[model samples]
Target: MDLPVQQFRSEVEQGMLDSFAALQEALPGAQNEKVAKLRAKAIERYGSLGLPHRRIEAWKYTDLRNRLGEAFPMVRPSGGPIEQSEIEKALGPRIANMDAYRVVIAEGEFRSELSDVQALKKAGAELRSLAETLEHLPDDLEPLLAETGEQRSGFEAARPTGRSGAGPDPIIALNMALMSGGAVLRLGDGISLDKPVHVIHLDGSGEPVGSVTRLIVITGKGASLNLIESYAGLGGRGLQRNALTQLVAGADSHIEHTKIQREEDEAFHLSNWLLTLHENVRYDGFQYTNGGDLARNDVRVFFEGEGAVMNFSAASMLKDRQHSDTTMVVEHLVPHCTSRELYKAVLDDESRGVFQAKVIVARDAQKTDGKQMGQALLLSEGAEFDTKPELEIFADDVVCGHGATSGQIDDDLLFYLEARGIPEPQARALLVQAFVGEALEQIDHEPLRDALTGVTADWLGVKLD
Candidate 1:
């Protein structure tokens, strides 16, 4: 069969082709053979599919070609200049008292001084940079990495679309072709770690830089762990970060994920997290996106065993010309599993935000209870919200529902507060915060939840009543 030829013209598609070809040339015969083979397959798939554009359903809300005007090469392995004091200075007050395990990546480069290997080892866990663990990464992970440019499948699934007549996503292909720094943490059976593990990804001033930080966390049966990811950077010039995380929970295990994305105003941030749950396991997550020019969080969860439960919640505050997006998908593959998701967006000035969520229940997955809701507060005439919430159930016995609302603050509530001797601006801010408070209440950690509320208050420039 002969394929059409014009499907290869867009600069985005051409850039991907050139980038992948260069990577293939740079990596010569059989050294890192598996990595090389995966790269080749990804390049072929991308070249045939193109870049993901507005026409693609999954990427309809966020367009990569429009955001990333150009492509950047993966910097060759060179340990460059990085400052430890700068990182310590930028640490937020929430984590100031955290004496827990730490691993830091500066300007896309790993820093040892900021990493706590001893603390990690003492907790019966293993921490190694991706470069050092290259010999140990499993082969199954390679397919997931390579097919990132293509659609995703499995117990949890979502079809990735290519550009307007072009084929798959090249940026994802670029990540697989050039990922150099990441980490893996594995917990022993029945072990519980009270101390949280923090992974920090930082960016600095330079020729607009780009990075892909990958992390794999596996908890043993009956084990429990708490994880905190801090995506921090001194709001600077144009910088881009593409990160991916995979979490696997054993039977009856508990996992908690907390993330802070406070990148600079000109930075471009994109993040994706995929999680798998076994029987009776529980997973909870919280995310705060208060910075960055354009940021998107894509989360996928698969409930493979009966009685598994998952919760995903997040809060985002946007101002200036900043743009933020949070998209999540949950799959119920087995009977008697449950999932609950709540996401809130507060947009001000000329900012824009997007929230797309979907729940999928398989044919045999009877009695699956799933619920999702998204609420947004528009603070300015220029602020915009694009929301799509859907539920696809293949079984009749399942109970699944979803809803989304995008509107301004309630005038009656605002008026009532103002009548109570509060200034109008302060009253409006109070109502917005109260609207978002319900999602924060679900957070189990006191300090983290309070920290997120503080950020929200600061963004609104109001003190809580």
Candidate 2:
């Protein structure tokens, strides 16, 4: 006789289910029938799937289920007043004074007082909080939420074959079940913004808590805009953050997107980015990650129409025992599309870094051109880096390739700098900077690029001349 198999549920997993049950009614859009049904389905999916672990190939390196031993209780914003100075200080000098339309989200809730709402409106942009949008659920939201059959089928088909096979993402499911607040921005056809829009995320709760936030951006035909997202903590302890951003670029639109993640060292940060591109669209995206005790960045890009171009790059700096993972999937569903990806990572101390990227070209995507590369620089013997680059093409005419490299800094380069009278530490820092600079240079925005360069230099403990 075979004994019954016992199912094991970690504290974090159990807490998530319990929290959803408790907060379902209080969650945003709880009264809307459609939103209600969506949340119910998401929670059900989460219950069935549980948290990701080593058994899943995508999560093999980062065992989130075991790493996040205990879950922090979900906390609702108190609607308390906050000072602008606090926001400025949290953003630091590099980003605080940037000339951009600023929007502030604190503790998972949008703070209009801290945001440039009036200015944004005057600039002919339609902006609303997720809560406000949910109150009167619109038709466009269903697609952004990944509820459409087409979107779902496309994602399922593109996913790599492994133990995790086509399963719903637990993190995304949990966020959909518990999402309370976020921001949504829409630009009409032919509208062009004079300045970039900066969304500032600040974790300021005094106690340990779990927060979920979402950002949705929709651009109409021929529109052009620059968007920046920055995440920082205000002396928060044990903050568990789950953030997601959905971006839809219309035909002939041009968009430049940048993200900077620098949460507190003790926090757990999980972020997902979903991008959809249409015909004749141009998109450039950059990400810089250097914070959080355990962080994972998940990005998925889909080419919906022909003649679209996408350029993506990222840089990560990890020290101590921090674990950082960057996973991306770019799917070419149509012909005449182009994509390029490059990633750089610097690991110090006993920190570990992981980069997994996959590019898929469908049979009909004949003219698709894609290339991806991931490189890492290890600073110490204990530092670790793992990279997996894959290309799956169903079309023989498509041009697609991928490569990954991991190694320490070149002693010859370091010695060359030191021999020129540079201090040992400074020389090492310069070498590391040059390694990551390749990715940083992909950012077209001068000020933003400069700021990120400063961030990279600071991480190396040396100022660049």
Candidate 3:
């Protein structure tokens, strides 16, 4: 629980604890029972184990205590109607043709004009605001919501420790404590979405604000859906966005989830994505983080049945003094499951990048195939990248391996491109793209991939001829 000796203990950590203590007192007994229970449990855990510091193996590379040394004021939920232009401006040009509607949350409040509730209704999809949905969540979904921090039943074979209790995470606790608005999306059985649904979280130039948003997605058997999430902060200093997404994919269903973060240079961002895949289900994810003072994305995926497949890829373009971390855990619980993960980071100026990936195959999960790779390009003298890729396979018949590489741009490729009359900046940009293009190729949608390419080009400050 003690912070690294180099840095002073976090006062913000204390502030968060105090805030939770106050909230437990202010909230009525029946009104906030669930959250109160979670907070109480978390506090007890914090008292016993404290926050997992950099000493913890799982948090060695990116020291969260250093990032959250202080606390900002919590964002209140009183706001005017949300605007569509705000979403457009934040999304910039990453958005392609979206037949699926959108849900916009501005400073922790839902914006109607930015969402397409009517369209979802017409398609037999259920789209409800978190406030209303939580009041009447279906009985079947209640157990799913329970933060059993413990591993899922099917995944128990992967981690023999049998540690499956979901305790309070400071970051998650911060989100639950301050959450004011969010979205709930559900797809009916056999329904296929014609377009990808986009959710935009935007912050404005106001008092330093702290906000939390939650999203829950459920897919029925044989259904398919594509979901895109974009996060942005407009001219803000010291703003924080803590977001969480929990997805449950049904049998024979397919889901593609993409997250794009381009917040202001001074803002802070933290996000967690937890996904559970059933038999014959497929899950694909692409995450892109381009701007932030301190940003971290944590992803956890579980394979619960036979023939399930999961693929996750990420591309990060960091510059200046920015700091970004991508941490993921993938577990194969059943036989015949497959997973592949590839992450690439491009660092320039004095920025830093972190990638930590772990893949686990259970003893009984024979024929499981899992592969992981993390590669990085340091474009400037001060840029840096740290990677940790690991595989713990208990199954004797499983195929599992992982590798990591970090180095500067390939001089030979740069020279070859320059020899072709490509200028230095353009040549470097092209080579960097070539290095990461393989991951982009995994994207099924051409337009979206092209949009991401454009974003990369812009990040490199090069205009393709």
Candidate topping lDDT: 2
Poorest 10 consecutive residues by lDDT, candidate 1? 157-166
Better of 2 and 3 by lDDT: 2
Candidate 2 lDDT tens digits, 1-465: 122222777788999889988999998898998899889887776777788888888889999888997888886687787776776677778787889998888889988887888998899898899998887889979756743212222445554433433445778888888888889999999999999999998887578999999999999999998999999987858888999998999999999999998888888999989899999999999999899999999888989989999999999999999899998878898999999999999999999999999887887889899999999999999999998888778788988889989998788988888889999999999888889999999988899989888888888888779
**Could you arrange the candidates by TM-score from highest to lowest?**
2, 3, 1
Q: Which ten residues in a row have the lowest lDDT in candidate 3?
A: 159-168
Clashing pairs in 3: 148-166, 149-164, 149-165, 149-166, 150-164, 150-165, 150-166, 151-164
Candidate 2 lDDT at 412 equals 92
**lDDT tens per residue, model 3, 246-361:** 89999999998889898887788888888889999988899999978988898888888799998899999998889898988787878999999999998989999999888878
Order of quality (lDDT): 2, 3, 1
Candidate 2 regions with alpha-carbon error over 4 angstroms? 1-7, 146-165
- Write model 1 residue lDDT over 225-300, tens digit each, in one string: 8888888774476766878787889899998898888887777888878788999998898888988888988777
lDDT of 3: 0.75
Clashes (N, CA, C under 3 Å) per candidate = 4, 0, 8
TM-score of each: 0.89, 0.95, 0.90
Clashing pairs in 1: 49-167, 49-168, 50-167, 235-264
Comparing 2 with 3 on TM-score, the higher-scoring candidate is 2
Each model's lDDT: 0.74, 0.86, 0.75
